[model samples]
Target: MMTLRRKLTFLVALAAAIPVVIMIGLTLKAQENLVLQAKGELNLLMRTNLAHIARDIYALCDTVNDVVAKDLDMDLAAARRAMAKCGAPNLGVESADWDAVYPLTRQARRVPLAKFMLGDAWLGQSRDPAEHVPVVDEIGREADCVCSVFQLMNEKGDMIRVATTVLDETGRRAIGEVMPAVEEDGSPNEAIAAVLRGETFRGLATVITNRMFSVYAPTQDANGKIIGMLCVGKRPETIASIRKAISGIRIGKDGYVAVLGGKGRFRGSYLIAPKAEDEGRNLWDRTAKRPDGSEHHFIRSMVTNSVAGGGRAIHFEHYPWPKPGVTGAEIPEKTGACIYFAPWDWVICATLYEEDYHAAADKIESTMTSLAVTLSLAGLV
Candidate 1:
């Protein structure tokens, strides 16, 4: 038991284990620090991206509103006349005449022309064929005003209905009026509703569906009746184009970018893997649950109450899962993930295999292990 060879072997083994343990501990600490740093960097990048996206959207809305407002004066009387004369043969009108009428019709002040026309058509009962007539009638009666409805051709060369209403300046009882029925989808109506409710609705970046961001704003008429809404919308392709452009910019291996809503919902996401579903999913709904019935610490950090203000940026964590719009705390962890939030409730999140982001640390740990083994062998020799 007291042999010199045995004593020497024990001493060498102790020495090797001590350094190896120390090396491993230090490596782990460094890795943790690196990961934290990476997370911070990614969050910052996400915040910046969101700010830019918001700015662009606001600008686009402004441009559209300005163009429409300047071009058409929000006239109800002219819209009424046009509706009455719709489908009249020859209409005895030229393109130039139609163009001339455009400015005059747009310039008319808001009035109850549609309500009067509707009452006249239905004898105040239900003359209009559209099912939305009742709703339009209700809006008209409540607001006591009317607005301008525009006819424009879509990419499909089909005529589309677009309407805009400003606060009534005249002491008229018309709140708003519906445009003549057009063939396009009802996205424009949704957009107008959002504006009326004081929400910002803008085109989002996604090719699969038309995405929009809704923000709230106040409305006031000449009599301060707050008669209706003015909303602006563009194609979702606007945001998709931006995301595609950013993808061309390199970050690191597996590096990506995303745009989130104030509610931490995915407005736009760019990842290596394709997404299964698109639109209307919330990020906070996803991150709060785990498979083993245990909650992830990272996701819990991102939850918070809604804040006021139009465009203030904030920072927080995100948990992905629950599939956006899910209610309650019971979510599967396989559905949970962590992300970072920026001001304005914009979020950017990323998760990849450890090797993708920490290659350098991995290599260093491997080298240290080899050194530990070599030292132990030399001691035996």
Candidate 2:
């Protein structure tokens, strides 16, 4: 143990280990700094995307409000008569409802004499003018001007696509169709119901096949009774765009940013911005386990934190598991960050392998072993 060759070898091995340790320490520090920076960047991007989505929705609402304020002037009696006659052929309603509210058709129909509808006594038609056509046409013009979808619902909770950018499969106005507040999937649509209850409603909702950022306002009659609802909406493409923007971001060899539904029964279901294979898979209900064999409710945490923090990013750690096309082979432990987009009830997430940040440590350990082996062989010589 006291031999000069052994002493020299020990010193050489120590020298090699020292630098490797130091380099690894420096790298770990730098990697931590980079990770923090990336988190900030990711959070910023999430907020920016949310802001853009909000703006589009607000603009659509503003457009609707402006149009209604400028052009909506309906004479209740005349409107009922016109819409009733307009709907008579389809609804089999020989007359209006008991409350005298005209039952709207599921589809819009052409008024028999459009020229005489706008109080055009100049047309000299002895028949009473149809008031509904002018109001419906005005709503349509406003919708076209703003390039937003619009709908008008009678007080009886029957909605008609009077004038809208949204078209039906028939390429015609989605007239006469009963636009229920409930979704196609039978989900309760509280926002639409709120509008019917004479409250303003604004949020993300499905408009036809696509989800949209929308607003609904109650329209009042001359007597101040809430007669109908006016709605305007714009497609929320920003979410899709955000997904596209982040798709190329690499966290680790297999890590990525994904979007998930943030709230309610659909929580954890992939939406707008997830890989195609991941769509409709309910991660919240996933029975996956962590490396320690503990049940991991990763999606629940994402939703809870985002909601609690008011859309702020929540950082977490997880053991990587199989996701859609990704097999669980050699999957490393991961660090995840998520933020909520409340407008659409969506969560945006970023994840990276924890091992990636400590990769230099692995190299350092390997180097130390190699140096020790060489030192021992040299000492033997």
TM-score winner: 2
Expressed as tens digits, the lDDT of each residue in 74-113 for candidate 1 is 3233333443343211111222111111111443332222
Pairs of colliding residues, candidate 2 = 105-176, 106-175, 106-176, 106-177, 107-175, 107-176, 107-177, 108-175
What TM-score, over all chains together, does every model reach?
Answer: 0.38, 0.54
C-alpha lDDT of residue 195 in model 2: 66
TM-score of 1: 0.38
Clashes of each: 31, 8
Tens digit of per-residue lDDT, candidate 2, span 136-183? 334444442212212334333545433344554656444333455544
Off by over 4 Å in 2: 1-163, 175-190, 193-199, 236-240, 290-294, 313-319, 323-332, 367-381
Candidate 1: residue 42 lDDT (0-100): 56
Candidates in order have lDDT scores of 0.35, 0.50
